[model samples]
Target: MLLPNSKRILLKLSGEVLMGEQQFGINQETVAELAREVKAAKDTGLEICLVIGGGNIFRGMAGAAKGMDRAQADYMGMLATVMNALAMQNALENLGVHTRVQSAIQMDAVCEPVIRRRAERHMEKGRIVIFAAGVGAPYFTTDSGAALRAAEMQCGALLKGTSVDGVYDSDPKKNPDAKRFDTVTYDKVLADNLKVMDASAVALCRDNEIPIVVFSIREKGNLARVLAGEGVQTIVQGNK
Candidate 1:
């Protein structure tokens, strides 16, 4: 499915992708390559916002499963996202791309607070804004944070760059015969539990009428191709 004309977009990336082939944590080479791909897309004149998950460093749910307080674990996960955001910001700046890191949780030393107008101005000045901290609350995934920011920023679409090329009926890795959908409706995704994203994230996009384009960011040059409506992806939107 081809993406619609989008002047601004929010790119939601799984933090695990930042790990490259490592067991955990960010890989410098992988981050650099991803930055280049983002730079290529930016050169096309599209305003970009980024939200990277913290699964690579810490996963709140995983911690909670081990008997940790859910809220405390989630807060730790949020901080991890800030670290990832900083790494990405550094990489983008190294490539001569102006970038900003806005955290939902305020940290005067490292980044700016989430100010909607300020973020808009940064984008107006050709700066990519990376939002961190997952809505400044517990039990919320970065996916939900991405959706909230996309709606608030009035982004044309939310581009989810993940390991998989598109949403499938089942786990493609485990189920060899899993069916990949070119286009799927939000309602179906929620009903069947397709896992395109967390339920809250999907519902937010549905309510705001923002298209979610899921594609493989691991594939070099795929981000640009998807932005150009030429890559393999699944477009999740309101029913046609």
Candidate 2:
């Protein structure tokens, strides 16, 4: 069962997850499975908001590093995220889960612009709101956008669904002996450069006293398992 204070959560998913086994672009079957998981979580009566990254399509920093204009690359990256948000929206709706896509960089024809009160109303009506376009600015990541929306929506927790199960002392893929943390302080995560999230995202959650739950999304049924506090995960919170 979730703590009494954790009725609402903001979920952040990397775009790569949408690719599934493919090297690039959205994989329909994978997204359907993810949508089912999300619907299952919502069925537990939790208000959910989502932020999806665009790394599978394009990354502003990667483009900038390859000689493109940084701001232009970032705008392109933002567009990529919008595409991903639409894809997820379709998948969720196919599962009979109502969802709304609100873009920071609004294209009114496709989706609504980010309006805090409107978003809250949507969730109140049992509709999930997916935030797209990171911060509406260059040099910012979707992680920061997720944190910002999580704060704006006053979500009790930010659930980061990644490939790894939890935050580790080192890169678990490279260091087979790396230790996973069951719980860790915000300061320790930042000081150790744990890579659980960008520094800004972590700091924002820390400042707001919102706990960040890190867990693997690829595993079947893990989202609900973690939400029920019965799965392997790392909880990042303030020092007691």
Predicted model with the maximum lDDT: 1
Query: Which digits, one per residue and each the tens of the lDDT, describe model 1 over residues 36-137?
Result: 999999998899999999999999999999999999999999999999999999999999999999999999799999999999999999999999999999
The pairs that clash in candidate 2 are none
Give the clash count for each candidate: 0, 0
How do the residues 1-240 of candidate 2 rate in per-residue lDDT, one tens digit apiece?
654597788999999999999999999999899999999999999999999999989999999999999999999999999999999999999989999999999799999999999999999999999999989999889999999999999999999999999999999999999999999999999999999999999999999998999999999999989998899999999988
Q: Which ranges in model 2 have alpha carbons more than 4 Å from their true place?
A: none
Look at candidate 1 and tell me the lDDT of residue 50. 98
| Model 1 ranges off by over 4 Å | none
**Candidate 1: clashing residue pairs, number:** 0
Clashing pairs in 1: none
TM-score of 2: 0.98
* Cα lDDT, all candidates: 0.96, 0.94
